[model samples]
Target: MARTYHVYIMSNRHRTVLYIGVTGNLAHRVHAHQDGTGSAFTRRYNVTDLIYAEPYADVDEALRREKQLKRWTRAKKLGLIRRQNPTLQTIQGPYG
Candidate 1:
């Protein structure tokens, strides 16, 4: 199978801590976070909940989206997250 890439967001329970990241293996990446091995920010702030994600054909596009998300203001990013994830629920495990 071909490897897939994704740009994703992780947020805290209150949807306060937002984390933007890119990964070639979404499941493994999310699992790492779930296992407390993802990133310092996530571990420190308990940002292990997957809030949103967008898949891309390649790393370039994924990186572009990741950067864009990072640049968005907190409110704007929250709007985006709410649009895609109305209930602010975790994605319930990684998907392709």
Candidate 2:
């Protein structure tokens, strides 16, 4: 089976911090963040709320999108995410 890559956005409960990441296993990666094991940044900021995600066939495409999203202003990022999730609530269930 072909592998899929994903670019995902997550935030703290207060919505004060945003995290962008690329992963082949989105569920496992997000679970790690939720458990404070994803990265120094996510752990330090307590950013574990999964808000937005997009899949790509190629890892490079997912990585490039992650980089692009990281460079965006907070307002821009929120805008993009709001298109799918207006309330910015934690998306439940399987996102992969």
Candidate 3:
């Protein structure tokens, strides 16, 4: 079965940088981020932490959310992250 996932936001411990992304496999995507193979921005910014995510049943919804996140202001993004992950814990590694 094809899996769909919503957009997600990731940040470092200090929440100094943000990485917005979408993937059908959240675990795999998070793994890639931790591995530094997700994207140049994430790798450069050391955004290997999964701060927030919202699942969507449809790919279109996920894509829309991703776009919306991209357009969000920094404060809005921080609020979103803080709502779900106030402590800013590192998303466990793929195997972990």
Candidate 4:
């Protein structure tokens, strides 16, 4: 079976911060973020809400998209998220 790659976005409750990341295991990564074990930036910003995620068959594609999103302005990033989540509320993680 082929492994999947994901480009994911996380945010704090107040939507005051955004974090973009690429991971081979979305569920594990999300768990880490929620538990404050993901990264210094995420833990420091209190960005634990899983907001958006996109899967890719290719790791390169996922990495490239992650890099692209990280470079975007906050407005642009929010626009992308709004396209899928108009209400901009916290989204359930991919896994239960």
Candidate 5:
């Protein structure tokens, strides 16, 4: 079986803070965030909403994309999210 990876962005309720991460199991990872056990930054900022996600067959590519997104400016990140999620709504499901 081929392993899949995902680069995802999470945001706070106010949509002011963003958190980018790569995970092999997107649903589980996002659930952890929602449960406030994902990361210190996410838990502190209440960044539990799934704003954006990109999938890749390679974990290295997902990690690279995560790094690239992390290096991007807030505006750039928001733009990327808006391009796919115009309203910035929370994506609820296995892959959103």
Candidate 6:
């Protein structure tokens, strides 16, 4: 079976901080974040909301996208998220 990769963004409830990450299993990765085991930054900032995600066929592509997004200005990142999720709602659960 072909592998799938995901580039995702997580934000705090107040939307003050954004966390970008790449993973082969988005659902599990998000679950870790939600469970407070993902990263120190996410845990400290309380950034568990999965606001955005994009799928890629290759891990390299997903990593590249993650790096690109990480380098973006906060405004640009917010714009990107807003474009896909205008309401900036928390996207969790299966396949999140």
What's the TM-score of each model vs. the native? 0.92, 0.96, 0.85, 0.94, 0.96, 0.95
Best of the two (3, 4) by TM-score: 4
Candidate 5 deviant stretches above 4 angstroms: none
- Residue 12 local lDDT, model 5: 94
Error of 1 at 35 (Å): 1.3
The local lDDT score (0 to 100) that residue 43 gets in candidate 3 is 87
**lDDT for 20 (candidate 5):** 91
lDDT of each: 0.87, 0.93, 0.81, 0.90, 0.92, 0.93
What local lDDT score does residue 71 receive in model 3, on the 0 to 100 scale? 95
Error of model 6, residue 66, in angstroms: 0.5
Sliding window of 10 residues with minimal summed lDDT for model 2: 87-96
The best-first sequence of candidates by lDDT reads 2, 6, 5, 4, 1, 3
- State the lDDT of candidate 3 residue by residue for 34-55, as single tens digits: 8999999888888888877888
Q: Please give the range of 10 consecutive residues that has the lowest summed lDDT in model 1.
A: 87-96
| lDDT (Cα, tens digit) per residue for candidate 6, span 13-65 | 99999999999999989989989999999999998899999999999999999
> 30-79 in candidate 2: lDDT tens per residue?
99999999999999999999999999999998889999999999999999
Residue 91 lDDT (model 4)? 81
Q: Which pairs of residues have clashing backbones in candidate 2?
A: none
Q: Which residue pairs clash within candidate 4?
A: none
The residue pairs found clashing in candidate 6 are none
Residues 1-96 of candidate 1: C-alpha lDDT, one tens digit per residue: 666789999888887788899999888998888778998888888888888888888888889889988999999998888899998899986387
lDDT of candidate model 1 versus the reference: 0.87
**Model 2 spans > 4 angstroms off:** none
| Lowest lDDT 10-residue stretch of candidate 6 | 87-96
Q: Clash totals for all models, in order?
A: 0, 0, 0, 0, 0, 0
